[model samples]
Target: MSFVIRNIDKVIVGDGKVLSNADIYVKDGKVSAIGAGLTVPENVEVRYGSGFCAMPGLWDTHCHVQSSGGIWGVDKDMLPEAKAIRAAAQAEPVVLSGTTTLADAGCDGNISFALRDTIAAGIVRGPRLLICGYMIRMTGGRAGKDTEGEVDGPDSARKATRKMIAKGVDFIKLGATGAVSSPGMKQWSPQLTLEEITAACEEAHKAGLKVHSHAYGDEGINLSIRGGADVVVHGITLNDENLQLMKDRSIQLLATLSTYKAKLPYLDKLPRWQAVKHIQVCELLEANFKRAVKAGIDVVAGTDSGMTFNYFGRSSRELDYMVEMGMTPAQAIKTATISAARSFGLDHETGSLAAGKAADILLVRGDPLADIGVLGKAGGVAQVFVAGRLVAAFDECGKEIG
Candidate 1:
């Protein structure tokens, strides 16, 4: 298939630069040529830009496309079969929301990857899936209890990682700290020892897989870096030394700020019965996000979806949080579009709108660069495309079909 997306008022080209009156030629699921006023062949499809702004499709470096019913700070029992159904349910709206590529954060293991494969085959429309089959964690660690996978020592961690690799996973995830959802665990507490983390990272690296770590606080962050973690999923609170270390190491951070803000509404009018532990998470996020950016660490975008009101199909709220943290609109967009793909090791395939890259792009009615809030409004994104094919088109009601 070939098409000329012509007369774009402004095109966000590669490297975060915008071009005026540009046209994009797409052929065979990749951008063929990007230029201005290019004449087109008679047989080629001509797609009118319609005064909308064109930019690279957004990417979510971390999300959970699983089924767990609960409000933020609340937990509910979930069955594996039901979780698979819910994962498929969430994926549909995500593709409509303009996220073309998503890194599912360890929602399945070797046993559950069969369900993931079914979802990939066409159960619903969503971003291309790059899954971390099952997260490796010390026994009783964060994701371990929730997802039912755990390992204590080097040998066990290596064995578990090899099993995931054998299942053909794209990457690996490790929990270096106790998570907020886990009972009696502080947000900053380190769960996995450095030795365990190193074992998992080494095995995953040897298998040519990227390693992402869930971490917060000083000890957890340090362990992640020392373990050679490629992506730091969430570092909600960090010290000066940790910031410097991440910057020096070029470790990418996926600051899923919305996951914290989603709890604000619950706290504003909290009853005495409500738990106050979640307050710690909010406090740490405010402190760490500003510090990480000041230290010049590359902070990418992420949303810990499936966590209390953090919906799978909605990610624009994350960009809003980035702006609230003092990032300029362009920088916030970069976090989700280009920087995110780089963090997930998919920059060669997709990210920016450039020749020879996947034609994953979005058409928004207004300039998202002028107002980051434009992204939060569903109406702003008029059309979404994946691999050079139109997948979702919205009318007045945001009634989109893929």
Candidate 2:
């Protein structure tokens, strides 16, 4: 099957440049050719996105569809069945909203990937799956205080990484610091020492995979980077030393501003002791990100969607927050399109609208370069193509097959 989308208002190309009055050709699910006014071949699927703007489909670097946790709090027995249901619900709004690739945050383990496989195999429509198996944690580590990621030594960590690799996980996740929700645990508190994180990263890399660590403080950030993590999920609090290390090591950051936005309304409800912690996180994130940009560190746009106070699939809001934080609209788009793919090492395949890449693209209604806010508006996607298949049309929900 082939498609020749003609007369697109603007085709946002790979280098973050938009071509006016363009046409795109797709064959065998790869972009065969893209130019202006090519002679249309008979019998190819043709569509006119006249009032639309095209760009690479949106990508969400961080999200958790389901795991042993409820919508807002911990749900210890997050069975595969429950996970599948939640993932299904989560997949719709994202796909319909124009996202094609979404990276699952630290969820699923060797013990729970069949559920992920089921969601991938079934009728769910959204981003392609790239998931971290169960989070690797130290005994009484950061993720769940009650339910410990307690691996005894380096050997145990190695064994756990092997199990996740054997299960065919896309990457590995390690919990490096205590989180806000985990009561009595302070943010930036290091959970796994250098040796443990090194063992896990080495084992995963040896098997030709990458590691993404959930770190917060300077200690956690430095240890994860030194251990050779490909990306640091959310290290909001960093000192000059850690910032330099991150820049020197070339580790990317997934700054999740939306997570903080969602928590604002509940500030009064938080325990007196924890109230300051939330405020501190918000302040540090804004300040540290400005420093990261100044230091030439690559920062990707990621919304920790599905966390407490965040919407399920509407991650476009993150782009708006990025502009408010000092990134230009073009820079914010680049973060999601180009920089984001580099973070996952998938830049060669799906990041931008380049020839020979997978035809994962979206058609928004206006010029995103003028205002990033246009992407967050409803009905922005006129159509969404995943691997050359017009899975969803404008204002359409699911696949439309005859």
Candidate 3:
């Protein structure tokens, strides 16, 4: 036995099914066995606990960890090297928050890639990252200044997609529409044309990677799905057509409400006009969020954790927002677990507590199925394990912890 977590009160799979009184056995770095009785090797460590619930570790499908930390205290204007240090420090907080896997929605190539490699080598503590080095955008697309790759025509879009593939990106990010945070642009308006979007998607898919579109509104979302994009980053203003498109293509929508959730605190710092516009667009988004959730589509959750006041370790809040939008605790958790894993091509390695999957597990003090909000509280999570190794731990009394 490489490690063993025995005497667990219950084991919850990513899909919300619970296994009672189970012992999860691990060998090397994967779950080797899970049953009622399991014996551990004498030399291997054992973490036995009762009155706790274990499940697959959480996955945040949309995030920008480096840029989020850069805005908080650390100067975003600093050199790349200094910014990297700040970004690396942000990863531990996310891991402690119970997220074992992360997808950087979009970020700088230098910082996010370095963080991804560093985490992979075990040089630092962070989630297994599915990264897009930068977002490919049109000339007047959302996040133009911060976006890494920009193109003008079908040919250019294809080239940009290929370039990111050369850069070793796990997925491609596309700015399919305008954004609320961007000035002179409406959040529900399309930015890139059908030809341009299709070119990028075709190239990305050819290379065996998924394309996540920063899209909103029905038409914009429909174009992305029809163009062959695999995921929509923010389709909060979507309609019935978008739902049909998602179902038809087997695509997923990655909700990023956590960005709007931060607007009030950060609005005072923005220009009054821009701030008001930001609120207006999100009001429309919040209204349609429930409609989309109730449509019975494949939905995943993320914090988009890089804007002002939207820091790391807050991805769990997205789940709460999902529950508020009509999903049950189990369904909301599924969005961040197996659903998210399947969306991003990580289900085989993780997203469930089954044999042959990576031992990415979390032990919580209370039953999330009963009180989902407990998952957002710091003390609710008792332990976090990644690849059969313990990464975080807290005691039941909430005093003694590692």
Candidate 4:
């Protein structure tokens, strides 16, 4: 299929540049040309926009499509088919929100790989997916049988990683520290031995997959750094040395916040001890990331969506929080676009509006660069495309393209 998206009033390159009055030509699911007066064959589908701001579709680095149930992550009590159904349902609205690519952080069953395949086969309308079948953790760690990749030693870690590789996970997810949401758990406490984490990272890297480290506190953050984590999930307690180490190593940070469910409404529901612990972690989130921003760390964007109250399609709210923390609007968007792509090893395929990348595009009625908040508003994105094909094009109130 071919497409000519004409008369785009402005385009956010997903780098730091913006172009005006540009047109995009897409052929075979990739961008063929990008400039003014780009002409295509008459037989190609022509899409004329009425005052739309175009840009690369958004990228969300961390998500949990399977964690659709209430607070309890996985109900082993539920049938596997039921789990897959809810997870699939959660994926539908992501493109409508302008996120054309996302990754499932970790889930109980290996259903993530199945979902990835279904989406690839065009059987499902969702973003391109990278998935971690199960997150490797220590026995009795934060997640129990619900989703444990429980490994006790280096050997076990390597074996578990190999199993995930055979299961066809695109990447490996590891929990280096206890979660902040489980207030009663020890904060900043290490869950896996450095040796175990090292083994997992080494095995996954050898298998050509990256490892994402789930860390929150001091020691846990350090273990993620020294243990060879490629991406840090939430280093809310990172210190200066940790930031420098990550920068020197080129390790990336997902720097997620909103999806942790650490907000007041959720916290109020927590037990006093847990709520107090969560508040401590929350207090450090902005300051911790600001230090990262100052150190020139590769801070990518991710919403630990599906955790507590974080929804799937509302991933753009993460960009809003990023701006509030310290990034300029452009930089914040870059974290979601180019930076995220680079982190996930997908930059060559998509994440930018260049001529050779995948033609995953989004159209908003007004300029998102002028008011980044517009991206977080309903009906702000007028259209969404995946692989150069029109997937969603309408207003919030049901106005279809004329």
> Per-residue lDDT of 1-402 in model 1, one digit per residue for the tens?
999999998888747799988999999989988889887778999998858889998877787766442553343455666777767777767778888877777765332365457646765666776788777877767532454458877788888888888878888999888777566567678988888889888988888778899997789989998888988887877788877888888988888887777766766554322236568767677767888888888888888776665677778778888888888888888898888888867788788999899999888878888997766576778888889888888864566644
What TM-score quantifies how close candidate 1 is to the native fold? 0.93
Sort by lDDT, best first: what order? Answer: 4, 3, 1, 2
For model 2, residues 233-303, the per-residue Cα lDDT tens digits are 78887778877888888888888878887777788866554567778798777888888888888888778
Ranking, TM-score, top scorer first = 4, 3, 1, 2
Per-candidate TM equals 0.93, 0.91, 0.93, 0.94
lDDT of 3 at 132: 92
Clashes of 4: 0
List, residue by residue over 35-134, the lDDT tens digit for candidate 3: 7778767887777857789988998888875565223334546677866787788888888888999888777748889999999999989888889987
Screening candidate 1 with a backbone cut-off below 3 angstroms (N, C-alpha, C), the clashing residue pairs are: 72-308
Clashes of 1: 1
**Taking the tens digit of each residue's C-alpha lDDT, what string does model 4 give over 273-351?**
6567767877777788888888898878898887655667778888888888878888888988888988767788888
Error of 2 at 351 (Å): 1.0
Worst window of 10 by summed lDDT in candidate 3 = 68-77
Better model by lDDT: candidate 2 vs candidate 3: 3
Model 3, TM vs. native: 0.93
State the TM-score for model 2.
0.91
Q: Candidate 2 — worst ten consecutive residues by lDDT sum? A: 67-76
For residue 294, give model 4's deviation from the true position in Å: 1.6
